[model samples]
Target: MGKKFLKSDEEVVDPKATLEVSCKPKCVRQLKEYQACTKRIEGDESGHKHCTGQYFDYWHCIDKCTEVQMQSAACSIHCICGFSFALYSLYCMFLLIWSMERSDEEVVDPKATMEVYCKPKCVRQLKDYQACTRRIEGDESGSKHCTGQYFDYWQCIDKCVAPKLFEKLK
Candidate 1:
């Protein structure tokens, strides 16, 4: 009369497997933008070659969107517990200061700058540098190796971009 236990090898199917998962429109849009940027980076062999600034811009966009999604999820939980207003106020203040700081520094569009200033010969080296950084970025080895990777990536970018800029300027 005891209930029979399924064997460990037996597959247990979820009843909700047919249900559709929906994301907020903003979240969907952000996901699309991130995907598009990733595709562009992957596709444009020459255009993004010497453009570390563009790479940084894309990375920042994805990071900001991810943060927004995380904050929105946290806000919902906080709202249920009556702390959402305080969190929202702090978030808004942080955004304002961040926006001001971002505006203080003029961001040069790297693609345009490279088109104007960099030589074609540097493209191969730039591509290699970008590939190196991309690999390091995906490394799961925590902060132990990240500091060295960061240094190497920046050094590679500098070597690839700086000389071309100086040579073109002169």
Candidate 2:
């Protein structure tokens, strides 16, 4: 059987940049619904009781939009670049492993390696940030409760994690 390639009906925006500006029709409809829900929530003082379900639906619509965008981007990259990027990534991974093995003569403590990579507090904060992202992956509307936590996490990574990790590399 012959392999099917690009969808003949799909509009190509930029073959080089792989960006699709127009979303699918269903996504457009869902976006309209989400916007209407938002407007209603904003206008009504007691809208929270009635709008929670709509908010979840809106969140799901946005999530689907993101999924479609990512899928299209991946398809564009694969179609344009083929296997070159994949091969390069594999080559880099090989070099990293080879270099690590070459330094095996020196006794390296795993704990020390981790400490050099990031401070203990930074590591905890990073984990918390990751967990928060995962927790809100399905219900991103809940992220408001985590805004301060996210800020702290990024601050730790910027001020403590990056410096330690870069210094260790040097």
Candidate 3:
């Protein structure tokens, strides 16, 4: 008998070709619906016909993306937006505007926000900063790089968290 090749239902269906393969199907649907809503918001004549009170859901989608973007940025040095890093950039822009729009009393500094968002990473950076300072001053006492040691606080912190701080600095 000749060998037979069999294809599973998923392979036949090719969900990757469609928009239905994600674990978060609801989020995917929300993104599509929100894009449709935005077309109407842009005053597109064709879009207005399908958009009735759906605009509110559009805003909710934006809010959701922002939350996910911030979360992904915090947890992983890489963004969860995946190949669509631009969406994450949009999320950062939205965050910047949202933070600025708040009143002075409500506004939180970036350090406080960073501490909350990326606590472990931030604390590690702080420790690195301290260590770097000891090295720059040539203090061998309790220094890990102990043997005629000198440290640069600026260099260590800057080196450890340069990429992270670059985002905020910009």
Which candidate's lDDT is highest? 2
lDDT of 1 by residue, 1-170 (tens): 55578899998864222111221232344456556656644644334223354456555544544444445445444545555477675775566556445532434445446644444545555566566666655444333222344455455556557766676663
lDDT of 2 by residue, 63-106 (tens): 54545455544555554554667875565555545544542233
Clashing pairs in 2: none
Report per-prediction Cα RMSD to one decimal.
15.2, 14.8, 24.1
Model 2 C-alpha lDDT versus the unseen true structure: 0.52
**Which RMSD does model 3 reach against the true structure?**
24.1
The ten-residue window of minimal lDDT in model 3 covers 142-151
Candidate that would win on TM-score: 2
Q: Candidates ranked by lDDT, best first?
A: 2, 1, 3
Q: TM per model?
A: 0.24, 0.27, 0.19
Give one digit per residue, the lDDT tens place, for model 3 in 1-170.
Answer: 56556666534644322322222343455557767756634643332133443555544544544544444434343333343677766776565555445412222345434434454544645566656545544332322332222134333434555466668885
- Stretches off by above 4 angstroms in model 3 are 1-3, 6-11, 15-19, 26-36, 46-170
